[model samples]
Target: MAHADWSDPTPAAGWTIAHQIAHLAAADTNVLIAVRTPEAFDAVLKRTEAAGSRHADLEAAAGAAKPRSVLLDEWRSGRAEVAAALRDLPTEHGFPWYGSQLTATLMAPLRLMEVWAHGQDVFDAVCAARRPTDRLRQIATLGVIGRELSFHAAELPLTTEPFRVELAGSDGRTWTWGPADAEQRVEGGALDFCLRVTRRRYPAETDLTAVGGDAQAWLDNARVFL
Candidate 1:
């Protein structure tokens, strides 16, 4: 893409295409820090806390100010560092993250969802098409796992009521969660479900079907990220 192409606006409020990629790079760096050293992670956390809610926007803007090639290279470097750190993480340990903690196993899918969700914004902004990948299963899995967290974030009461989710995969297969006989059911294409789960796309914009009010409300507030 041309340098000017980086200025393209995405669906995320107040974020240009460059900002989206920059956010990923910053997030990758934070993940690397968290995985490698809890002490360094806490220092980074203090810096972000001082910025209040603007920390993410500020980080993205800083990276977005760099040249496209520089930004891309930095992102690549940070991603590789995070990948290695995650692989080397001890099995019995979890890392501090945004006032919570996550094991390497869970953190990996969360990062994947973050990248894919932001990548979707870029694709939508440029009107580019992307083929659905098998990796979407990981995202959907994260969505399923994060349902309770999202519900709490949305101020919805926690309910143990199980909800079934059925997705038609791009690879000509059906991926499902919960019991087949569950009353609350969500059905949709895997891509659509992934998009909605990340809040990159609304339920109405996708082919998702919610069989119960609770299920519909879950879709309305779906978000895999903190």
Candidate 2:
């Protein structure tokens, strides 16, 4: 999108198209720092832990102020560097992130999910349709594994009881997680589940149906964040 389009508002409240890209840049930078220097990452965590969302907003605002050409080049270069850094990391490596540890293997997929999710906001802002692709499999898998992440971040009580998830993929197939016979189950379109978990759309607005009270509660609190 052009500079004018960058000013256009996205679905995320108080955020613009530029904000989406800028946020991505900010997040990618954090991932890069985490992988490269643990001590530096700890410093970052210390600084941002106090500011929280405000810190992110400030970073996005700063990134948005740069010239479009500069922003694109910087974001692109940083992402490529991050990819290279991740590639060099040992498969068994673990990095501290946002109050938790993340495996080296999961970083790439998590980054992809963030890119797609933020891109959705930009696409929506510009009235463009982005077709769902097989990449959603990675996101849906993250959504399942990270179901408790949001709870943990929010300091909510955690649950050990598992809930079954069954999603109808865009490719006319089923993707499932957890025990099939679990009493609590969530069944829905894969796209809807991804959007719900990403906090892009309210669960009530999606095609998902919750089969149990716990399932509904999970749907409400579930969110994708590193």
lDDT of 1 by residue, 38-71 (tens): 7788899899989999998999999899998999
Off by over 4 Å in 1: 1-4
The per-prediction CA RMSD against the true structure, in angstroms, equals 1.5, 2.1
Best by TM-score: 1
lDDT of 2 by residue, 1-226 (tens): 5535687889987788777788898888899888888778988887787887688788788898887778888889989998999899899799888867987788889899999889888878888777898889999999988878867876777777888999999899999999988988989999998998888898778999988877777788888874
In model 1, pairs of residues that clash are none
Candidate 2 clashes between residue pairs 3 or more apart in a chain or in different chains:
none
Model 1: per-residue Cα lDDT at residue 212: 90
C-alpha lDDT (0 to 100) for residue 123 of candidate 2: 79
lDDT of 2: 0.85
The candidate 1 region of ten consecutive residues with least summed lDDT is 1-10
Q: lDDT values of the candidates? A: 0.88, 0.85
Question: Which one wins on lDDT?
Answer: 1
Report the C-alpha displacement of residue 144, candidate 2, in angstroms: 1.0
